[model samples]
Target: MAESANPIPRKAAPVRTKIDHLRLDVVGPVATLTLNRPERHNALSLDMYHQIPEMLSRLEIDRTVSSLVIRGCGLRAFSAGADITEFTTVRAGAEGARLYNLAVAEAERAISNFHAPTIAMVHGFCIGGGCGLALSCDLRLADTAAAFGITPARLGFAYSLESTKRLMDLAGPAEASYLLFSGRRVSAERALWNGLVNEVHPPEELEKVTYELAVEISKRAPMSLRATKEIIGLVRAGQVRDDDYTTALRNDLFESSDYIEGVEAFLGKRPPHFSGC
Candidate 1:
């Protein structure tokens, strides 16, 4: 795989954490968050939802991490969705459902609002809540064997509006309706057609491809990435024209040190060392 323009070598060992059914591995500038319960197809337990926000909050302030990749530990699935075994206890009643729903919303919100870009590297089954998780990411890269679906219809419950909007935004209402209404899994190729995934690679190449993309993105000016993400979100929220804030943001970027460096690097025919100023 190709390295970043301003390459940061791999660490002697990746900084890793093993807790809460999630594993975090931080290399030089890309962090990978793995859903770790492969025994259950990495089914998300209730506590995993609570842990996500907390984990992301830490990463949000860590300047060392410029990009994040989310995936499952094993090849069987990205996730099988929320742990059904917990439904009897964690999502049993109205209040239980409410709390569970709140946690899911918070976790997804954290991902959507994360400072750095997020990529979902999907393989095998990405269903129900798992599909929502992938949609929350800024990008989704999947292997050919990956399958995606929004399956609330099968569960006899309504999907959250926030999650529904995300699906609608990416795949549009018609395709989103098909997934939600039929609860049928789509092949990775179909997912690509629906705009659910950015790319689909052979299973053997997915990891190398995903990390290569993440590393390439990490080498860019951080300020540009952050601003662009925010601006895109604004556009998604119906801000079609530039407002005062957008105008100011654009003006500031032009005056930034990284912008000057980029220009100079182009003239010098050398890679820019972006300090993210």
Candidate 2:
């Protein structure tokens, strides 16, 4: 048979980069981020530390996104914490460890400082840095199968003050101490009781429940949500002083379109269509 000429053209391949290690997806007013390293149970890699903050920066300016969700690739873990294999290589010496820790700190700060509300959708093992990630979010929603623990004691490392304070804020000093001291995984029931998680669902219900919650949050008045988040942060840090910045934000609420719409909708006996002004 004679050779036939090929007619179909192949599509161009997408450009790729190191940050592809993290998957970022935005749908409507919500963004979902998946830590793409599943073979290591979604261990937070070195690239991820830099990538997380960069991605968060993008979302910070994205007005369309009202919320963000961070999760691992599979049901096995939200994350297994940092990539331990790198410790023997890149993070070998004290200086390396310090640098690595700094990267991790910046990543956590990015998440915690995100302008919009964030949620930790936890399933399976959320340990060490993973635990820190979950704690950074405004809320934690998990499957009953999920477990959480801070394993710095197990790794022969002391936990950072900010991380410890977050644990203390949520689980109380006693519970936080117990976890850090023991490095034992806490069951979902225990985590929930300790206030480590907001809600626990069956495995099948976890995603459905989490997305529903995110959707509900996204529909609310954006400025109100942002103000509430800031207020909560001030309360947490005990920085409730009415400085000029704080005073300005408080005043802006009165001028916001959302406030006017809310009032009109209430008086008109209709659902408020807040423009998130």
Candidate 3:
């Protein structure tokens, strides 16, 4: 047979998510959300962005969960960023891009506003929107050889204001501007020095160091940690108002069962069993 001169075009199959691009598993009092796309360096699709906030919301009210950790499954990357190939189709123009950016912003806010302390356990490449994800967390811990960058400029795209503001809050103007302008990957040491990551450990020690931090945070009084996280965000925004919510947050901690346990434990010279009340 000569075969056809031209092949007929067929519709692409819709992406399957029965097996989630994101996975949530609760280990003891800690909830770990793993980005499950290592084949593409855990690149995030629109669906993964949407799923993150949902998982965060679920964990926010689960009293049993004392903390949350976000990471990629394999060694190559925490996440390479948004799936850029999606751009050619569903994300082709300004409107599509606007909607996509909105989803990304919402996911970031969810992480930043999460009720429990959250950690970004980064390894390998954490770039573009990946950096946004890490910045959204309460803390970022990176492998010593990990690479970090935020490169909207490389794509001829302006950085989103909310993401830029968060990055600025973490690294200050000079460091943020340097990263944004050059769009170059910085090593773990440079990332630590620039305040882009809280700590950097050798690849062999990355998990040990990150989870140790998570464990220490989990052992603290949960209510106090949650309130502190909330207040610090306000402080960063130059907020000083003692409004109703602020006043309540300040007062209610004293009334919590954890408060009583903390005090009793201090006096008794024993570990406290906080109920997170």
Which has the greatest lDDT? Answer: 1
Considering only N, C-alpha and C atoms within 3 Å, which residue pairs clash in candidate 1? none
Evaluated at residue 84, the lDDT of candidate 3 is: 93
Candidate 3: worst-modelled 10 consecutive residues by lDDT: 1-10
lDDT of 3 by residue, 17-44 (tens): 2237887766666667789897899998
RMSD for each of the candidates: 3.2, 7.7, 10.3
Q: Best by TM-score, which number?
A: 1
For candidate 1, lDDT tens digit of each residue in 135-184? 99999999999999788899899999889989999999999899889999
The per-residue C-alpha lDDT of model 2 at residue 241 equals 76
lDDT of 3 at 55: 74
The residue ranges of model 2 lying beyond 4 angstroms of the native Cα positions read: 1-18, 240-244
Which of candidates 1 and 3 reaches a greater TM-score?
1
Q: Which clashing pairs does model 3 show?
A: none
| lDDT over C-alpha atoms for residue 214 of model 3 | 73
